[model samples]
Target: MSNRAAYETVLPYVREWVSYKVWQLRVPGVQVAVGYEGEVLFDEAWGYADVEAGRRLTTTDLFRIASHSKTFTATALLQLAERGALRLDDTVGTYVPALVDGGSPIADATLRELMEMGAGVLRDGHDGDHWSLLRPFPDEQELLALVLDRGQKVPAGSAFNYSNLGYALLGLVIAAVSGKPYNEYVRESITEPLGLRNTGPDWEPARADEFVVGYTGFHAARHRRRIDHVDTRAMAAATGFHGTASDLVRYFSQHVIGQGTLLTDHSKRLAQRKAWSATDDPAGRGYGAGFIVDRIGDREVRGHSGGFPGHITQSVFDPESGLVVSVLTSAASGPASLIATAIVRLLDAAADADAPGTPIPDGVDPATFTGRFANPWGVTDVARIGARLVEVDPSAPDPLDTPTRLEVVDADTLRMTAGNRFGSIDEDVTYDRAADGTVRSIRGGGGMTSEPWSVPEEAPETAAGLR
Candidate 1:
């Protein structure tokens, strides 16, 4: 099936799953957006932006987006490189002489190393109390002091030592080379040219009220406390971006080759190419210029994850299908990656149903057999994706991992045609209908009964020390 067709089949399930997960896990709020073939196919939000104030979250609400700023920083550098402003192999010390003057080992690190996190600079300097709001983020003078005091802890390029300080130096390099402030250059060259109205490099006092109130996790605490938004100061290039989910997916979509004119096709390819392994597993994960090279289902995706004080976010793009998914949340401990991965997995299932080898059973509308059912064991979702029906365990971390394909057995009976060893293959699933032609209950293998399940009308009550 075409990418658009697959998205149509999977979008309904995506919405229901996101809504259920947010409520089940007691997340403060979540905003999700999907981009397909240069267009946004699905955009939705759930839960409250401000829990205590009872403010419902909306698609337009801005999120901190923290580490996602690295992608923007990387893109800005690549743009400058294309214009013959600087070279990737140039040592950062060539632009920022403070490192050389301080005799820091990081002075020898190249721009490429810093962008890909290969530089041995300290992750967040000696003290990272700013992350917990105990101290203010370092300014230019303090950042220089931090670098001179304890920035380089290991030899450059010895290993993948993820460092926010490394990117901060790159920010300084951008300013030194372009003769314009890092944030101003990024806005004029990236966001403005791409028409990204909701995106910015850092917190804006003028738009303070436009941002959603972020909340702490309910770990070891009776209730989640609100986290005050603060600027990342000199580290804004590394961890201080704010935007709506819609604009984020749209911005990343430009990275997909030939999708947008923001960056040259050559630059996009270089940004998406795997430069170094991010993990020990040979084929597990890797890193590009600023993108996280990983897999969602069977498709390789390039994107990034962001974690601010009380906001967690994840964005991934499937280059093969040109499908991009972004999940933004208000709680610091939210399952942003989990929700984003599930969306891609569902799309993979829908695309599999269209494969020539897997023939979808005909003469029985899969929709009639699709609905959420509850038994004493747990909840089961019979989702209809592109004319195929699969039983999904809603609570699984990856819902489509071991799907049970249901086939028509009779008017009211279905048979499990395919599944893993854990599933009961060829088992009959009979359902009873009410007078109005609505399903009342279902009887599966071993004669276990399940009734229709619905999400709660309101958010679940929070228990002490637990959501």
Candidate 2:
């Protein structure tokens, strides 16, 4: 709308921005897509696909979508519901008897409930080592075993804890009800029909050139550990699929324009409804089937966020203005919710032909701000990391900070990366200057902001305290 450049320009910095975010947060890579009215407005690929190889991400980069995969699974289920084959309220036990055997039938779980993440469940195990009986790398049946054996972590219809195992079972229920494998259903119904190329449920390392190689986040795990070696087979419907942002724009476009030929109007609206509400922060909002529905400032957003070992994917399309945005990172960046919040703010202004003003990067001279400023949210240890460049602590031990590279996100505020889901540093490192043009203090990352410390003349110089 009004030359894509007006909107697209803000997105490409993804490479540079994510690079800083990765350095600030110690993440690996990021891929992002921003759009409106079902059309891609902007898309960016930043950081590395394989950091060791020094590979950079492209709009075509691919990474594990993780729980974002729930959107597809829930969509398929809702499609069936729209067809009168299933009901969001139908109990899982009614269809898949084995789901309830001795304990309770995971099948008895309502499709709506599963989509809303209402199923009380425990994590499969955070260590990422336990394999559910549900399925294995090549075999898919182990998924079912996982639900049956593990049962629900909590009573169904309880709190908002997330369960990857829950969506997996929903996939099986789709099979039992539709009589088709989950992959076949997604491809034939979702991908093929949507014409989303370069998108699928797994990876082919040998076919590396076709898609982006996933990046890892374990600082110590590197060299001896592999984070991208995720179990694509067992992670179906939760964190198994991989695709490009360009394709995702097309996919999200369906929800905006009603994909009149594919997804029905009712189904699209159904997908946008709220199901679960996060209680982590008091400001948390509610969840829909697969999407987390909420408001930012005042704008309402419909979408979901995902995080696996090494990838983060966030996608959302506004229902009214047809605005949409999707960011796929190759590292564990921050919560996608924050991004949705950012988009809502930007788009609200964009819809009115306005743009947020750019903030100045830390403008204070290094000398006025160079000191061992102590803070927990972030520590400011100003040290010269390179000639002619004074590196600030936790902000520049980075493999990515450039001289003018700082991101002045707001008029007077500076931010490095986002929170660490995409491996971004979630800090508020803004600066304050004194009337004398000297720096005052710095704030953010959950601590106070300040200028460089001034030593008293009465104090002994150099290691005086130590002596």
Candidate 3:
């Protein structure tokens, strides 16, 4: 199937899944934007931008995308390289002379090493309490001083150690090489040319009202207190970008293979090349310049995840399918990455066009398959929507948790089809019937069994309403 066709097949479940997540995780707000076949297929926002003020989140609402700023910074550096202004292998001392004069180890590290987080620079410098919101982010003077004094934590060209400080130094490199401030250069060159009106190097005072109010303490507790936004100043190139979900996906579209409007094909490849293995990653992700490269099934995806004081965000792009997904959430601990990846899995399942078993015969009552069942893991509800029988997890924060489709193979046996973070699923489901012809329990190939469950009398009004 074509990319658009694949997307359309899964579109119906997107909103329901997102809503379930917002309700399940108690996320204050969320924004998601999806691009397919060179065009945006979905751009939506959910919940509130400001829960206390009763402000609803919109597609245009700006979020502090934080570490995603590194991608733009990396792009700008590549742009300079393309123009012969600099080379990736050039040592930091070649551009910024202060580190060399101060005898900092990073001064000997090449620009490529810094960009790939293999320079082994300290993740943050001494007195990095700024991240705790106790003090403001560093200015150029403070950042330079920190680098000059603390130096590298590990030897250059060592294991991957994600360093905001490394990107911050790149911001300085951009200024030193381009003779323009990092933010000014990025805005004039990248955002302007791309017509990304909703994106900027940092939060703009004029657009402050459009920004979502980030929150803290929401991950572990229901009560979340608002946190104030701060300027990153010199660190803008590292973790200081603010943008809407739509603009983020659009920016990533430029990086798709054969798109080539921004950087040359060679430059794009160099930036996306796996420079180092992120061995610490349980998912086996790799670091590629500014992007995190990983595989979902057989397709390779490149993107970045961002975390600020109160906002968490993730974006991934599959060049083969021309699909990009971005998820932004207001809470500091939101599952932005998980949600984005799950959506990609759904699209992949649609493109594969492989559902389990044949459809139920016509004239068979769909209600026969409809009921709520429970297992040790959670509850699963089978319901008929239109002409299809779908299994959903009413208790899951992700509505997409249930099987995509359930097809009857016999009176008491069925096959469940669904997509997960890794890929597609096709498994048999068997139902145990009581003497009265009622489903006593349901079991899947995985050995998990779900017994009949009814909405409890004391269940929350909201829970009952979902039935």
Candidate 4:
């Protein structure tokens, strides 16, 4: 199916699912935007932006996108590289001499290592109490002193250790090379060029009222206490960014294939290529230049996730499908990442539903099809619903997602019925059987193969009622 058709099928369900999640998680406010092809296909806001004021959240409200600023920083650096101003292999000391002369390991690390989080720089300084809001975020003097005093925690080119300090140093590099303030250069070079009005380096005092009120104490109760927003001065390139979900989706569009106008093909590839694996598994997540790289089924997605004191956000771009989703939440503890991921899964399911294989005759007993299947993505439960068999992701946050009725098409194949409440298109499930006819593996519509889940005799009942 075309992306537009897939988007139309998935959007309604995504909206309902997101609304259900906001209520289920007791999230104070959330904004979501989805981009398909070259334009936004879905934009929505739910819950209260200010719970005490009884103010409703709007999609235009600014959110502290936190570490998402890394992408901007990475983009700027890549632009500078394309101009022959610097090279990714250049050491930090090449731009900032104070760090090198002060015997800091970060100074010796290459810029590429810093962007990919392989520099092994300290995540935060020794006086990292700033994260607890005890003190103001570091200024240039303090930022430099922190790096010089604390130095690096691990050897350069070591294992993947995410370091905000590394990005902050890149911020310094941008200033030194471009002869412009980090934020000013980014605005002129990146945000402004892309026509993003709502995105910026940090909070603006003039726009304070338009910003979503962030909250703390989320873990203790649904109603969290308000948290004060602080200006991340020197760290703006690392953790200080503000924008709406729609703007974020639009910004990320620059990373999509054939949609990018901000960077050249070489630079885009440099930014998106996996530089270091975040997980040990080959198929697990990795860090590209400034983006998190991972796979949902067989498709690859590149983007960044951000977290600040009172806000959390996630953005993902599926280059193959040209689908971008951004989720922003007011509470730091909110399930922004989960909600974003669930949306992507739904989009994938919708696309898969458009093509259902031909059906064969039914011969196998329906009871034999009832079992839990396990895969890298998650668990899929196949259970007998009355006399009908269905498949469902019971762990999904939204309870309204209707199960796909499974019809036996052949001895080992089942065809998913069309027109489900979840809006997922029809697909097929094929089972691998052992010599004695015991199910070995179950392959779902999206090419996800799952092994039969071994269960204990005293385990909970695994039938349709579980949903």
Candidate 5:
């Protein structure tokens, strides 16, 4: 099937998994949106925007999409380049001479170096406690001071050095070249033109009520505390965009190759091309001008992730398929990438189910066999993806990892068609139902029994008994 078809087929499972994960991880709040063929197919949110006040998160609530601001900054720079305002290869000192006159080596770095994260600058400056809200984010003067004092980590273009400090400098370059403040230039040039009403470069006091209250990650010793929204000031270009997952996915959809009004197709190509290998990533991901270029399954994707003091967010799009996924969370330790990747993987698996000869039998309803089940061992979720029913381990890091394909036999019986040797391959799986036809229990896989999940799971009893 086409990706659009596959996404439609598996959307229910994706939604189920997303909701389950939020409950399992105890995330304070989450907003997830998926864009397919330039339209948002799924948009939902879970948990409380303000847990203390009992305010639920909505799809419209604004999130501190930190570092995603880089994409906007990079796009702004490319727009200027397209208009002959400035060249990417121009030295930082060419526009903002303060860094050069201040005797900082950072003045010699090119705008391209900064955008590609090859400028070899500090990740954040000394006294980075501002991230924890101990102090304010750097103002222009303070950011310049940080750059002037030993900011260069290595020679420019020698290696991939991820640096918020570099992008902050890019903001200055933008301001000097455009003769407008960084935020104003981006608002008029990018967000406004795109018709994105909810997106902006920094926290706005006027829209404070629309913004969700970010929260600290769960602590074993204490409850999560709320994090106050603060202006990023000079560093806004690097880490201060506020937006919704809906707008985020839509914005990222514009970055997909061949489908954007924000930049020329050529500029989009330049911005999304792999510029540097990310040595810090074990997955061997690469960085583009302002995007993280990585693979999920076999599909290459370009996107950006953001981390504010108490919020973590991820947005990605498959250029070939025009599929986009964005996850926004309100806690420091939220697994935004993990959740986003799972959505992609599930869609991929659904796509594979559309291949020839793997179709479910005639008159069989895969959805009838789908539900969450619990046994003494753990939780198992039987889900319908595309035309296939597969046993999914919801607790697994990748839910589709080592899945057992279930084939329909009769109305209530399914046979395991494929799985590891330890499983009951080719064995009949029967479901027991209540009088009203709701699934009561399932008997399958190594002859183990599981019932529809209910009741809270309790901690295992030790030799000393449950604590």
Candidate 6:
């Protein structure tokens, strides 16, 4: 039972959402969990994780956390930090000697930089396309060799450009410093201590009956097998963990309540503190560490979002409410953050309705909210046609394409219409323009962190060298 049932009032709203008319025309299955003031307010699952198999996502249904797994990877590194095995400022080259490209000092890069996406590497896969093809796939050392020769064009610690390769390197570092396989270290360091039984890499096969089989290639025009592949051997630290909503409820409870076992309060602060940015997101908001921090209703909220080919996951922590809300979706089209916002609003409303109602705050000034601001994510070379719009020549949709579009939507919000190209309808998280009246930054709904900005300092050059 919650200290207060008022928070659970979000359930009806969520039920309405699950059964909404717009949803049917949209995505397929979704699983969501709400933890309020550190307690499980609602832990319910709806829709199907495996639609073809007719598997309904139960509150306990396990789904691939996708890149939400990075949150755990960050946690694992912090654990190593607490033990003094490595410092956040320690260079990558210092920890994982193999990451050095041709004796270059990748190790001199700080863990803090790598953890925060400031490390200037591309979002390349851990191994070559043939990574999964090799028998007894190459270990981290061999994986490093695959990209070691491919040196970076940008100097280390140049602005924030997220690279999956960086975390992959951190995974290797965690393994080296702990003297244990990354998976085993994570289990002992995080899952075991937190009592998160349902959480681990390989959601299925590990639990089989309890885990939802994630599907890939959703809505692909071409017919393709809906396959579930676990690159745990190669991607364990960066993208390997799995768990259920109930487990997360327990996980949230432990942390928000000062359980004090798994992570120290100081470490928790480091975990949540804002660090880096995506430079520019199709949305706004600056990136901070692994989390995206933004303002909502006179309060700052911290969170992150993740999507794999088949799964999309979102989790947010409301410091004001001591509430942590997480939603995991197995469908490619499912929108998890939308679900999270709806839940948050419902709870906030319920919180107010429970007590004597305070006057609703005056709406923010309509003036400060409008304008043309660009931070690299949407393409709106053409304006909206009537009520509906189309995306023409959006983001460097190709590997060589430079994504440079200043998305224009309603004031203080980003509502992008998905075309044949973009799969998700991203939300624009609005920020209060600095008193300076220039864009301090803006954040998008995808939870990709944006950062403090300088406009004439016009937008950061995301297209430079694209040619």
Using lDDT as the yardstick, the better of models 3 and 6 is 3
Scored against the true structure, residue 62 in model 6 reaches a CA lDDT of 73
lDDT of 2 by residue, 288-322 (tens): 77777877556677766777665667777666666
> How close to the true structure is residue 456 of candidate 6, measured as C-alpha lDDT?
23
What candidate 3 gets wrong by more than 4 Å, as runs, is 219-222, 280-283, 359-390, 394-405, 408-467
| Candidate 5: residue pairs that collide | none
Candidate 1 lDDT over 396-425, as tens digits, reads 888877778787777788888788746577
Record all residue pairs in model 4 with backbone atoms less than 3 Å apart, i.e. clashing: 353-425
The lDDT-based order of candidates, best leading, equals 5, 1, 3, 4, 2, 6
Candidate 4: regions farther than 4 A off: 353-395, 398-402, 406-467
Error of 2 at 367 (Å): 30
Q: Ten consecutive residues with minimal summed lDDT in candidate 5?
A: 458-467
Residues 1-467 of candidate 5: C-alpha lDDT, one tens digit per residue: 66678778888888878777876777778899999877889999877777666677899999999989999999999999999999999999998799879988888988999999999999998767778788899999999988888899799989998999899999998999999999999999999988899999999999888898877665542456678999999999999899999998889888877787888889988998898888766566999999899999888999999999889999999876789999999888788999999999888888884432256777777777898898888888888887788888888878977888887788899888887758788898899988888898999877999999832433211100112
Better of 3 and 6 by TM-score: 3
Q: Rate the local accuracy (lDDT) of all candidates.
A: 0.84, 0.58, 0.81, 0.80, 0.85, 0.57
What's model 6's TM-score? 0.68
Cα lDDT tens digits for candidate 6, 1-467: 24256554335444444434123323445667777655666677655555555555577677767666677778778877888888888888887766654575455678888788876665664444432334433356555764475535366777777666677777877888999877888888878887787788544464666766544333554222344545556666656667776666566554443544666767777776666544466334555555566654445677667665566777777644577778876645556766666556545544543332122124533234322234455322221211112222222222112212223444445444343334435544555466777655555435554544211211111111001
Candidate 2: 10-residue stretch with minimal lDDT: 458-467
- Residues 296-333, candidate 4: write the lDDT tens digits: 65678999999999899999998655789999998867
lDDT for position 146 in model 4: 86
Better of 1 and 5 by lDDT: 5
